[model samples]
Target chain A: MSRWKPDGRGRLEKAALELYNHKGFEATTVAEIAGRAGLTERTFYRHFADKRAVLFPSDNPLPAILADATASAPVPLPPLEVVTHALIEAAPVYEEREDLVRQRQAVIAANPELQERELAKLAALAATLTQALRERGLDTTTAALAAEIGIAAFKVAYERWINDPDEHTLAQHIRETLDTAKHLTTPAEHAAATDNVSFTGQQGTA
Target chain B: MSRWKPDGRGRLEKAALELYNHKGFEATTVAEIAGRAGLTERTFYRHFADKRAVLFPSDNPLPAILADATASAPVPLPPLEVVTHALIEAAPVYEEREDLVRQRQAVIAANPELQERELAKLAALAATLTQALRERGLDTTTAALAAEIGIAAFKVAYERWINDPDEHTLAQHIRETLDTAKHLTTPAEHAAATDNVSFTGQQGTA
Candidate 1:
């Protein structure tokens, strides 16, 4: 009943997710969501541009945080490291809204249009990471490969984290996944080449 | 014209791409594409299932080839190496159809629906690679990450190959790009510890 509640956005997101889950994203109206949150439609609009926006409210801040993390990361960090730093910085934001995240994923899974929008968002994120890597003086191929690999790692880690939340923190899981990926990708001879032999090959197309 | 020509599929693809470029994919009918190819609609159907199928002719063979390559690859090959070998197997197929490939890229670029389809295809390819890797006794995280990174490397190399044909062969370009991605992603200090010191970090949210 407090007029000046600090968690108004959180409350609205919680209500919107519940409504979206129970009645579906298409059937859930802003008025109903506002009512469920004990707020006005105007307040709901203030929090989210629209119902679809409610499912992806934090996306706005994602680019900026990623950019900042990439920029502040230690210079000469490997391409994945640069990307991993950014993911780590962004984890807390998603962690704070795990339920909403799950609901959003479910809604997206059910709707092709929403899935396309999500894909576009991911593509945009990759583009941003590529640009950031380029700014750090990585060549075009390296930048693109780094951005892509980074995104792939993020995706696998995220799916695992969501499915098995009790096992490890998202950051830990992602790190472990990256390590394993690196290990698996390294050639057996390279694994044995502890002293001096450098494994050499063409970069991307092979 | 010889009725038993080996380039029947190529001719059809060329004709279809030209028609698609001129009239747009949605507006270009199968009959028109067949006419341009100097073949009957029945002949076109023999080669392709539909108009949309022309855009993705390699859909059937790519996964199988990738699976075979992954399965038959030398045991304990590095993740990138395994992916590189699979891509190498695919190189000749892509190299032989460079013109059609560029045309396909243009057509997909013009249509959001086509782009989505392409994205879905790429995602499926990644999944196939992951599954193949998993069957090799790699853990889920390692398999997923290796597949994703390999695909990322392939994508980067393919783009470069399509953009500049003179730089290197698709297989060579892919190999170089994979190496570049791996090297760039490797931590600076532990560059020597190729196997022991695994690079760990979070993906950038940006």
Candidate 2:
């Protein structure tokens, strides 16, 4: 109830999420969120621009943190390695806040608008990773490819980390997901090209 | 001027793109598009749900076409190849309508809402491809990974096909982009792993 609480933003987020899940995102209001957190509406506004902003905060740190990590990777490493390495390096960002992240995912999953925002956020993260790779001297196409694949790997890893019952660390999940994704591209040694059955060659007359 | 025209939908689509590009998507209206197409507003309604729907038509054929292609592919191919082969098979959808697709991309790029719809469409396409791969007997994680990378490859190739002056077929571009994406994961023989300098190994203490 103190006005000068050190974790005002965190309190507001937790309260808003609780209200959103209890009723619905559309039904939740800023005043109710603030009241739940035992803070003034003014304090809520100071942390977030609006109710929806509580879910999709403007000042996300993941993009910048991953980008910085990617940029600082040692030279000559392949772009995928550099990007995944950055992801592994930043795993604690989510690992340390797993509960909040899990709740946010559930809330966002229930709302179509928030789902769109989630996709946009992921796209922006890919763009940031692309820029980071470009800074590492990769071509635009290669940078984009690596960044997109990196984001895909991260998504797979994060989903498993959240649902995993074995209590594996996010980094281990990431390493496993990265290997799974890589294995998807590499043809099995037993599956020879001669034995491969490709798609019907219905050539388009372009 | 003829309501009975066989290509009424195509004409309306073309008119909408022209107006959207000439002015803007927000500024353009169904009446204006119908007028530009020399068709009645009712005819426009029969084709598209709304002004925005002109850009993001509801009856998107690409997903179903690609899914069918993937499902029809010969068995035992790697998931990536199965997906990319489906893409190559479905390339004619874009190749036959390059001009309209290019103009549509330009219009969508200028509008945030349309961009979101485009992203959603691509995500849906990935989901369809993933399901197709799952039917092909791949695991959920592997199927999703291959589908995502396949879409990324499609995006890269589509951009090149739209902008390339040499008039290469979309299938060719897709093939090249797939190779590039696969090559990204493979380490160079000359660049020895022992000699390779990886990320600073700044592991996150999760």
Candidate 3:
């Protein structure tokens, strides 16, 4: 008990998943999670805030990572592609966790509070991406639209990736989804657009 | 007290807003809402399931209306224009309620639980639009993306409309937002889309 364990967090996550699967999320306790992980309740507290947090993935540094990736992308890539690269670069953390992710999603789906938290998290991600695009010199509304489109693509891709029995990367699904979205949203009213407001070629970033 | 009022829902909504503004949402109750509306609690129950329902705009028929508009639009129009037409057709209901809409939004913002409910409501609206697009012969991913993008444009446009004290109608705002979205999401990689899945030249309702 006095010895240090480097895999404290990972063990707790795994233990929590097993217990959650068998005993259900609301019925499970923090002490039981720590016990399943062969650790003390003090160690659980050191890692997670509560039993629920163990099942939920951490998105702390992701916004910064996504923003940096988007800013560094090639000057001419469209907004969606820039976001695709950013999300793809950040997809490794979600790799190899298919079983856990599906299970966690089921647990969340069964609970309305968890579902709201999930939506809030998704909204936050979209807002972060929107700000990142704005920093790249796009206008506010354009940045917001592009960020939302990117998120829509990511969501479809994530669900598709998990549903397929064959092993596939989240990044590939995102790339393909973006292509489909691009083709789908392609403008047919270019004439109307030109008549409406001529672009200055240098769009402002607010 | 026994007067027969044909506009019970409208009166209840008006009364609820007055009370909510005076005493905050958490402090307000259904009995009070019914009392202010000059109706019985039983009457209020017949109209709305709860007090929160009064704040949320009834969207029961909106999905069908939007979908029907999209399906009936002229062929060769872009996805954004199709959505614009769909929303513009649906905008009449919102045209006369600017004050109520603004107040409802304010009331919703002040409470976290209401905010979550608002997000959920938005998601449902998006889903309904997605289904509508699907009926227009769009593939699943394309349909979902277009609907989400359309909703984003509507959200931005609605906010801009409320903020500007100017008297631009919601339909005009929606039209302008769609044009803006078109310029923003114009695709860069055109080669991959060529022959990937050629449009039917005359796309139609399914």
Candidate 4:
């Protein structure tokens, strides 16, 4: 068989998901995944640390994008708005890879280990967002709270979007989820001032 | 050596945490943990499935307490208030076992597998709350959204209570966090109508 070309990572991930779905995560092996991808064991190792890692291929640039989006957000935006903007910016990345996203979700749903890694990654993401908010001068508690809310909204939206593929774009679903959450928290009479609070800190990182 | 007692689960957990801290989770064995707890392997097996299970001692009673609190909560209490009552019911359990709580947190923090179990437990708790809410006839999405918010509040309250031992009671911290999250969501202008909305649902399971 011809050796798998340089795009071996993508090939391996696709192959692994199929095998995992058919044979079960525990029964699948590295050798099988590599063979299916037409790549050698060395090529698989060069891309992922293990078979599980294939399910959650890391995106090294996501954090930088999220950080930059938060930093460049309009100065007077409220914390929720700041986070909303960052999420909106990040939605395209997920949207572009809908198939891979679905496969990853399925794999995680099947295996407890993969699900745990997914939660850890989300927790790490929240921590990263909290740090960014803190850098903008929010107090530790507020930063953590805001980051949690943002992550919650993102989660709600993502799940809904994934479940209903025909209804709306991920970005729109996220925006709607945020609006709904905000509405639930806001009484109809007070909706006017919801946008008035400034979430960003005036003092730059010293 | 005398035969181990059934009520020695606590002792085993304590011993396990101490050993984990000193020797790491991967290196610790059931025999070592049992020896440290003055128990035998047979007794240890009677309480827990294995070493990792010791890290996640069952807290089965928490769900029933939370469900009862939510079911009997005063009608028309704000959404946050309803959740606060549920969390208040869970406080004594955690407060009474603060040392174990801290040790459990440390053990989970130290090991990735345990961390995942912790997340799964939290997710299960959230799902339980959501189901209870659905039983009250709330729409699926609203139920989920409320449960997510409640879990977020619980997390904030938990960390604060554990980290700052002198602070208000866990119940008080939970109420305050819910209120804070509420206030952060709603500014002064919306206070009037926000209070008028009746949050009660008819007693009917979805």
lDDT of each: 0.76, 0.79, 0.72, 0.73
Q: Write the per-residue lDDT of candidate 4 for residues A15-63, one digit (tens) a residue.
A: 9989998899999999999999888898889899888778666655567
For A64-117, candidate 1 gives per-residue lDDT tens digits of 888888888898588788888888888877788677788878878777777767
Model 2, A1-206: lDDT tens digits are: 67558999999999998988889999998999999998999999989999988888888788878888998888867778888899998899889988888888888879877777787788888889988887766666677778888887787788778888777999998887776666565566313321342321111210
**How well does candidate 4 score on lDDT at residue B43?**
83
Structural similarity to truth (TM-score) of each candidate: 0.78, 0.89, 0.80, 0.84
Q: Residue A69 of candidate 4: its Cα lDDT? A: 84
- Candidate 2: give its CA RMSD in angstroms: 7.7
The residue-level lDDT of candidate 1 at A45 comes to 86
Best by DockQ: 1
Candidate 1's residue-wise lDDT over B79-163, tens digit each? Answer: 6688789989978878877778889988998998888777777777889999997787655655677788888778888888888
Better of 2 and 3 by DockQ: 2
lDDT of 3: 0.72
Residue B104 lDDT, candidate 1, scale 0-100: 90
Whichever of 1 and 3 has more DockQ, that candidate is 1
Give TM-scores of chain A for all candidates: 0.83, 0.88, 0.83, 0.86
lDDT of 4 at B54: 75
**Model 2 residue B3 lDDT score:** 45
For each candidate, give the interface RMSD after superposing the true interface residues on Cα.
10.4, 10.4, 16.0, 15.8
CAPRI-style docking class of model 4 based on DockQ: incorrect
Least well predicted 10-residue stretch by lDDT in candidate 3 chain B: B197-206
Tens digits of per-residue lDDT, candidate 3, A1-206, equal: 64548888878888888887788888999989999989999999888888867765563566777888888988777666788888898787677566777877777767777777777677778889888877876656556767876776777788777776776788888887776555444454432432343321111210
When 1 and 4 are scored with lDDT, the better candidate is 1
CA error at residue B136 for candidate 4, angstroms: 1.2
